[model samples]
Target: MELIARATAVVGGTIAFLRRMGSPAHQAFGATPDIPAARKQGIMTLKMPAAEGWKDGRLPVCAPGLKVNAFASGLDHPRWIEVLPNGDVLVAESKEQAGPPKTLMDHAAQATMRRVKAIGTSANRVTLWRDADGDGTAEIREVFVENQNQPFGMALVGNRFYLGNTDGIRVFDYVPGATALAGSGEPLVAFKPHGHWTRSLIVSPDGSKIYAGVGSLSNIGDQGMEAEEGRAAIWELDVATHEARIFASGLRNAVGMAWEPVTQKLWTVVNERDGLGDETPPDYLTSVVDGGFYGWPYCYWGKTVDDRVPQDAAMVAKAITPDFALGGHTASLGLCWMPDGTLPGFGAGMVIGQHGSWNRSKLSGYKLIFVPFENGMPRGPARDILSGFLSEDEKLAYGRPVGVTLGPDRKSLLMADDVGDIIWRVTGAS
Candidate 1:
């Protein structure tokens, strides 16, 4: 028994040391990160901090001149949010259902993922929260759409409401002020299942087209590019004809997308490939070009070739560099622009919900960051709007921010905290 205990301690110590001894130092939060050498690992590394619910009267730390509070609570895995014209806030309450593992390592990874509460039985619904009186707390909360297929993103175009599910995009007729959607909408497009599952939806400025971000089937195409057909790219759908095609390719996981108000160019926050070490590749925010490839399995950050994939000169040449780097393994997911530039110190910029990372030794992200923009492009360093998600020792996670959007009044920011099961509202301190 003593021998077993000692062996366990040795193994844990070794892993801790390995996690700490990586080659590339963490990059600072900004546009141009100095990406260092890769420090690849042989096996999958697991370093998820256990989830600890927020205590009563405990709250996240807000930036100077800002205040944070629970807009709503007791949610089940709320992943994404959309604010309606009538000030209704809709949350996609969902989770990923782990499929049958194909390999022993796959099974082990899935087990570890479950242990971290990364995947679970999805609630499969969207809930509506109404703070009718403009108060901080939501007074009316009810299920808006039930029995969804792990819904993530939502967009209301005219009376037609679109919901991006794990396997398809569903549409329904929406009536303003309506609280519930009982009808099962038809699928606009059925996507290949079980890879990177979060589908972010956005409607064109003119409302003539819809874009859905479908992630890769495997990290760096381990499942082959065939399985990645119509994926690892943003899909453009015509609202009139229902026709769809790949808009951009090779974005590993473009989870959050928005249109820069000034340039009117489409932009996204992509989660770059893993296993490239602690900091060789940085997750980025970039403008999306039609028919352009950003380099996924084959390469990254424009010309940096990923040796794990087959080297193709043509593919690497066509790969365009991202506009800005959020940081290595930051898992930058949510993006929402403040068109009016009303939020003080956050002028003409966007707010991103960095879901945090579990791959690195010292954790990165797990907070809300605001990137100021000028002439439709990121211009300055990222500012932390809210933090304190991780405990002091960094051994436990109090919450992880996911989707972020402007509040009903456009004076506050609403963010979804999946682990904490709370919707946090951030406003200027009075």
Candidate 2:
């Protein structure tokens, strides 16, 4: 404990050390995490590193037996990546639109994001990248879709291509190998898109249903529940009828979604609500359940009541606990399944891109990680796939990874770094 205290003092000056003086981030990990008592600091701990992007061929430090390089760069805040059936990569480039901060905390939050260049007029476009030569770099770049409203999620199903703007999902006529859509898309479903604006999309294995994650309008319903209607839940849409229904509720900010190969279960990484100190309520990775309520506003971590919100006993009683904790404020956003043998020296598991944390004193995640799985369950501790995204002093972050997907080559991994505006490709070292 003395040595840890000594280490925290040098981590990120004084504020960081004070925040981290409670406990190391990793202790609040795994299925059964060490969740300390909740104490409302009412203070947002911002420990963002100065955004110093990659320069002069610098790259994120890869784990042993792995190498990393830019597959595509010079993007406009690419937030999500989707690999098409034809192996074409589509990037959803966007940023938060500036709005008046309602509180002093909100004001400071906005200032921090503005300094990091995280908020601006969004590009509102999807760009396509083609690595025709398979040399791991995109030689062809094209604007596939434009005039979007904070687009994030995308999917290609049969002849229909689905793209998610903050407000709704649009479907377009698409053909395999086609470079771009000919015209506008038809609206499939409308969502109340405001606070947590990102709408992540994924298709079920049978292709009969599509799932979209919609987040709450305010943290802990601070803006009132009336403003949070039809949000903080995963909406499942029927492909044939365009009908949508809530699949699961109380997922604060569920982003990444993927199917585990062995069990074929849907899984997601959720960014939990903050302000309850750093370690109490943790962001998590969990399997989604149909008609399940995981608790939000009123409860957290399976019936653990949050006194900040109006108490709802029935809601708390029904709140389901998540499967695994990914550390508080790590902002685990991007997730994808990596099959065994796809990358050398790794087994079948999930690859997660933790976009790092701003509300924590000590940074939690700004790198790619792999969680090993056995029989469709996480079997062991997470291993670092990529790291060194920040300076040694933890005061300078070069990049923050968001969306992740398997590359077309089947042997490489592609990740979108929103801060760096680059698509990084990782492959086993020769």
Compared with the true structure, all predictions reach lDDT values of 0.85, 0.86
Stretches of model 2 off by over 4 angstroms after superposition: 1-17
Stretches of candidate 1 exceeding 4 Å from the true structure: 1-13
TM-score of 1: 0.95
What lDDT is obtained when candidate 2 is compared to the true structure? 0.86
- Per-residue accuracy of model 2 over 281-322 as CA lDDT, tens digit each: 888899998999999979888989999999889999999999
Pairs in clash, predicted candidate 1: none
- Model 2 TM-score on a 0 to 1 scale: 0.95
TM-score versus the correct structure, for each prediction: 0.95, 0.95
* Collision count of model 2: 0
The worst-scoring run of ten residues by lDDT in candidate 1 lies at: 1-10
- Judge candidate 1 at residue 100 and give its lDDT: 79
lDDT of 1 at 62: 91
Tens-digit lDDT track of model 1 for 1-430: 2343244334433564677775456574566678876667666454566678698778999989889889999999999999999999999998888887787556555655554467889899999999988888998999999988889999998998999999989899998889987589978999886788999999999999999999988888887777788889999989888898999998999999998978899999999988766665889999999999999878888888889886778989899999999887889999988755456656778889999887666678898998888988888788899999999876688999999999998888999999999999998887
Q: What number of clashing residue pairs does each candidate have, in the order they appear?
A: 0, 0
